[model samples]
Target: MLKRVFQALSGARPGEQLPVLLSFMALLCLLLSYYLVKPLRDSMFLSYYQASDLAYMAIVVTVSSLVVIKFFNHWVGRIPRYRLMSITYAVMMICKLLFLLILPISGRWGTVVFYLWASVYFTLVLSILWGVINTIFSARQAERSFGFVALGATLGNISGAKLSAWLAGSAFKDWALLLSIGAMSAALGLILLAVQIASRDPETARKQSGTAALHVSRGMQDIVSLFGNGYVRGIALMVFTLALISMAVQFQAYGQIDRNTAATVYGEEFAWFDPPGQHFEVIYGLKKLDAAAQQARLKALGRSGNLPTAQIQELSQSFGRYQKQFESRTRKVLSDVYAYQGLLGVFLLVVVARFLFRFVGLRYTVLILPAFYALAAMVLMFPLEIALIQVLLVIGGALNYSLNNATKELLYTPTSEAVRFQLKPLIEGPVMRLGDVTASLLQIGISTALALWLALTEMSQGRLLLALGLLFIAAWMLAIWATGRRYDQAQQADPPRQELDLHA
Candidate 1:
């Protein structure tokens, strides 16, 4: 039954089944670990700081990512691949546990550390994970099976996000519990990975184990030399652009969440209530009483320009209720939005995505999906209806994630094992981090300028968002085209590795 399901969904042969399943499990655990804490990390940060602070955090992520990559390259040089992967996963889990233990003692600094730690952990771990997969699977197998493997990642994301949301909404909302869950998931992924590799015969396993004793370069110059290759450079830019588009869509989606939440609570007229300090009280007071009674109460308060002691006490008592109501309503709204996103991902993976990679072709499929969505996003910004905006953003986000993920792995299949291991860390780690930094800084500058312009000119920022989104998408499309061309050139010049049935 499991084989049938795998075959039906992913077009996997019996020979391809085990490694595919193992890769699926490994990616599932990796994403599950990350998503479990992602919401808490973002929400906690936003509670204490402005969204713009993410720009600073992005800078930290970029710098830290480079150092980690350098150290990672060193490990890739010294340790066997199997031992290195195991140690990396174990150390990451230890970090999570350590953070879990110290969070209570650390206070605000803990939030900072968690944010930075999560960022670096995600980059380093995912790069290594994909590198491992690239090592195990041949190009032919990866092309056929990566989308299917990514289906597991999609499900993992949904499961993890839902679990986090459930725990946060439940009465037993504890950060420690969430961290423990993430740690366990990480450890499970590592075990699965080891099993997958070991399941191969000893001879085959040892041969493919490390970098073939290749003298892989190690240093700041490694990244520079890696990019000197046209194919590697193209993949890096493709990743950068894809990350940029994803970032822009994310920024817009978050804005819609804030807007929709306010609209849900205060109605369309809420914007008018911004400047008047008393409007909130007046609105709440009116909702609680008849207009005549409300007018009478206001008149009484207006005479003294202050509330009576009893009235002040009554207002104070209701404050907690108002705050709780706001929080609950917003949580529900955001939950529904995220649930929609997850469903879109599942549908894409289980239904349309595998078809695209299998039939529609990787290069054009990758280009078309995000390009169309980017155009749709640009068009939809005109109305800015919360529902339409949210839905489109969710769909676009899901497609970009799954498609880019599956195709990018295929790009590494043509490279040598040493190049795959070393170059992947630089691309996935520092290059991707650099993309994030680019997006964050761009978001910050655009937001700051828009805020000031809107304050002075009383203009809408919607058009500005649309313009910038379109600009990023244009660059993204160009990157995709160039990368696809390079991929074709490389494939034509050098044929794929001989197909291997490793599990046999």
Candidate 2:
């Protein structure tokens, strides 16, 4: 039944089945992890630690992830992609065991530690896994199959988004139950990865590495070489743009989100739900309430639209007033209680985003990620007046995860087989996941700066988020553009004529 379902859905090719099957299976694991754990993030840890502290943990983990990638990239090339993947999973299994037993019993700090490891660890594995895929396939096949891969993640994402709310509403309100579910989902992904590797023929595996070679570090060489070589650098730049705009996109989207998110009661503001004028207030905050306004905006867009997130971020130069807009709204929002307003709104916004993926093609979708971010910023920063920053941020997060998954799949295609096994994981798992860790630390460092200055003057922290997000995005755009330019220039050949024509 499952095979039939996949066969029916997978387009472009009927002969190739296994990779599609594995991607879908992996996506299931991803979705399961997302749905089971996301809801409890606040309950488990945010209540205990400052977002800044959490960010620091991420930074630490990213650095460690980098090390893991280095280990894989330098050595894995000596072996087969599938076998190396199995080795990586074995390490993860050990970590999972330790995480399941040690952290659960260890309490708060333990959980936080595990969160960092869990967050950074999986992506580290995936990067190498993809590097392997890039080595094995042609560019065109990668493109066609990407959606299938994304479909798995999308299904997983939507399910996860719904699960958070669904579990809460149903009898499964227990945090322990949610945590258990999360473990199962994550474990499921690991198992699927194992299965994908295990399915490889024994004869094929032995041919590549009758003997296993030790892995070593090229030690920033890959990254440095990435910069030095024009083509590699281009891909890196594109990846960077994806990362940077992803930040700005979160804030911008949040700003627009406020136009729709009606205020609800929680904490000291509990009495305001019954108040007059609340409904009318945010609608106008949207800054584009008329049907004409929305149509005008949509009409201005191509399938992906014109103004990428990198460009829209330029508005921040308007006195830092619009930039401050992000912070003020965030502060206003934090004043709301989590149950009615924060959690509910964030939930709907992210789920809606899942479906939007189908509307855009992968390359164009990624190329313009920066612009979408800018749109989100315009809405949050200027319109709904930044009140719904969290909602927008969540939207951005979903986009970041989904869009990049598509882009990276393409990148992996052109790489050589050995490089894919060795370097790919480093790229996917550590390098990519490391970005999250970096963002967390960045948030903390900026927050600390604000705290120090708050006594002397009002430090605009919300704008601070917007600024960091924009900076990352802008730099990313420039890099990706440069990469694209080089790729377009990859040695095009003069036509090859028949030998008979030359003889004639």
Candidate 3:
């Protein structure tokens, strides 16, 4: 029964089952670790900074991603695939451990650093994992198996988010980081096991080790040359557009969450207090303030004269509780949102993705994301409640992780090893971040212009985003259609050549 289920889900042959299952479990652990810390990262960052600050942080992330990708590209051919994976995992573990130790003392600065690190970690590590999987499985196998493999990641996402929510709400929230570290360790072990199994097969062995013999240029020239391949350019465009859409949507969703949390904790008139100003310190530092000090600070800030002394005392006493409540609530909201996304992802990957891949074919499968984005944008054009926005986020995230992700990874199966290791990372890492940067700049520009000209708030920028999203969706659709044609042509030209040996 187990074998039948695996075969049905992944189309894995008898000999391929072990590697496929191992890869599944490996990815499960990888994503579990990530999702475990994701809620904490978002909550902590939002606690210290405004939702708008995400755009500035995105710029930092994109720059750091470029540097990291360049560094990783430099060693792609110089290091063995397995050793590189091991080393990357080890380094990440060390960094995460360090982050855990210093997070308490680091304050907002530590939150910023961790947010940036986690962003880079997700893209870089996942890129490497997919690259390794590409080498292990042939293109044909990948189409059938990748969705099933992604099911593990979907499950991990659900498990991690749910666990994080529970832990955050409980007294054991402090242990979440340690658990994430342990998940990473488990992922490393599973990845090594998968690689060892794949090494037993001659074709897989050659594919895995073939990059070592190729010459990799030590400069930007190699990366630049990748653009000469129209397919690579198409993939890059798709990724860029997708990232832009994702980020824009995320910005709106996060803004809503921030507003909702503030309203819930401090009431709808909380904005009048201007918590980002000196009152921020007063509110957060309430624990250290006695009633007299609190009244003094509020009086100095011209905020206490309107309220009665009893109400003032009550508010001051509850201010510390409200701060904690805000953080806790934010964490729970994030975790719940992610958990819903993961659940939807699992359902789509298990029930929808395979059917689509098997029947709809790769070309059309690539079109689903843009269509969904277009629909989502249309829905967001109207003023909706926070629940509606969360629904959109959950759907968008689910589609991206399940159908979109599997299809995107499958696109690289026919590419060369250099493309997988070097060019692919450039596309998935820095290029995607570039898309994020684009979205951020656009949002900043729109918000600034609206504030200056029409005296509109940031929340009013959704109409412009809807228009921009349509434009991007059109470009995304075109890129997918063009890239799909290229993919089909490449497959026909060399059906047996799973990994095209394009010497860099």
Candidate 4:
């Protein structure tokens, strides 16, 4: 019975009736958005925010939807099909304008605010968009075509990132607002989608339309109950772990690139340190004294009266020179890292991702990514090339993402109809965001402390980096073990429980 139910869900029109236009529109909107966001983000169109703000926005949406605003979702579902989709798309348009234009113009909101706007728009609309698709397509179609649908988004992402890269450091920087206008292009595609969907034939017109809709329809209540157990918790935690690795790896890649590439652009070492003006003031951080103070501090290095006056002066000059060299090298390394991991990485990510999910299942497959990440970090520590870190980022930037996203959807498979739609945001969005925030907090703190430690101590540079790498590896392995053990029991079949296993 369950098998038959899934069969009914696999096609746009029960595999009998095809959507001539709506399908195309859906694919178009997804691709357009995917292609634009990357470049917009990396561009000077709105240079004020970081990725965390985006995560925060998503969290806010999820929390609101889960508690105070959940009713809105039902209201959306309650609408007549035509009107329902119209409203969501209309909302999407409003939100997109706000996302693309507002921040670039106002320029007053702090980085956090900017981040929030990006995040909120991304989560709300994207979530709604998918929800609409889920409602429209049969369950089996939901599973298979969802990836194809997502592929549109994926292509958009790659295109956007490439565009941003191609335009980097160009005279077009001043025309950011004009560039912002490009996002409005989504409107055109969306409008096209509406028309196509409106024109598509209704299910009654198709053969086999009377087939069973799907299996194991349950309400949100039972889904919540399932999540209350350890197995579910383990699965959720797997997602959380994956997100952290992705984030940390990105940062690591960025830092490395900035460090290595600074040399090529600004000249050897200390090139990234900037014009040497601010010695005490930090931006988005702490304030310090000016360059004179910095120079004084450098001068004072030999004030311990251990070395001769001539030696001290020589050492100070040499130290400054060394610093500049370091910065230069750092910048070159980082920029290259970004180009490699952030750009070329998409296909690689998809390939490995599909392979793992196809063969290993979401649960077991998820674990292997971190091990790879740990290994990558370990390898980079040995030589510390910026490019190597970018490669590690494949695991760091994409691993958690690839694994967590797959796991969340997998985890929801056996859910009843109501629960599948209703609770997806809470479990996948808010919790996911919270995990991101916490991981960012931990990573920022650890990175800072390590920076300070590295600054003050005289430890071997290679050894210090290696030690940090080891620490991350240890943490990852520990999480993998614990999560596996917790969910171990769920893997086995039980009488009624088998019916509810996410594997289904």
Best by TM-score: 3
lDDT measured at residue 111 in model 1 versus the true structure, 0 to 100: 74
Q: Candidates' lDDT values, in order?
A: 0.64, 0.47, 0.80, 0.43
Model 4 residue 130 distance off true place after TM-score fit, in angstroms: 3.3
In model 2, what is the error at residue 32, expressed in angstroms?
2.2
What TM-score does prediction 1 earn?
0.79
Q: Given candidate 2, what's the lDDT at residue 346? A: 33
Write one digit per residue (lDDT tens) for candidate 1, span 1-504. Answer: 877887876666666676677778777777767767666666655433444466678878889988888888877767777678778877777788787778657756787888888778787777777777776666566666777788777766777677666766777556633554564456456545645654574422543653345455655667776667665676787777666656656666665564345334544334332334444545444434433565566455444546666654454334434434444454445545555666677777667766765566656765866576567766655656767767776776677557667777777765666666777888887888887788777666666785676662212454455466677667666766666655545445445333221112
TM-score of each: 0.79, 0.62, 0.90, 0.58
RMSD of model 3 against the true structure: 4.2
Give the lDDT of residue 245 in candidate 3: 89
lDDT by residue for model 4 (167-274), tens: 443545333323433443453445446445533535322212432232322345534653665544554555455455455444445444433333243333222333
lDDT of 1 at 435: 75
Error of 1 at 86 (Å): 2.0
Decreasing lDDT order of the candidates: 3, 1, 2, 4
Off by over 4 Å in 3: 202-212, 267-303, 306-317, 454-460, 492-496, 500-504
Candidate 1: misplaced stretches above 4 Å?
1-5, 104-106, 175-217, 259-336, 380-383, 447-462, 465-469, 486-504
TM-score of 2: 0.62
lDDT of candidate 1?
A: 0.64
Q: After superposition, how far is residue 200 of candidate 2 from its true place, in Å?
A: 11
Error of 4 at 488 (Å): 14
- The model with the greatest lDDT is 3
Which 10-residue span in candidate 2 carries the lowest summed lDDT?
A: 495-504
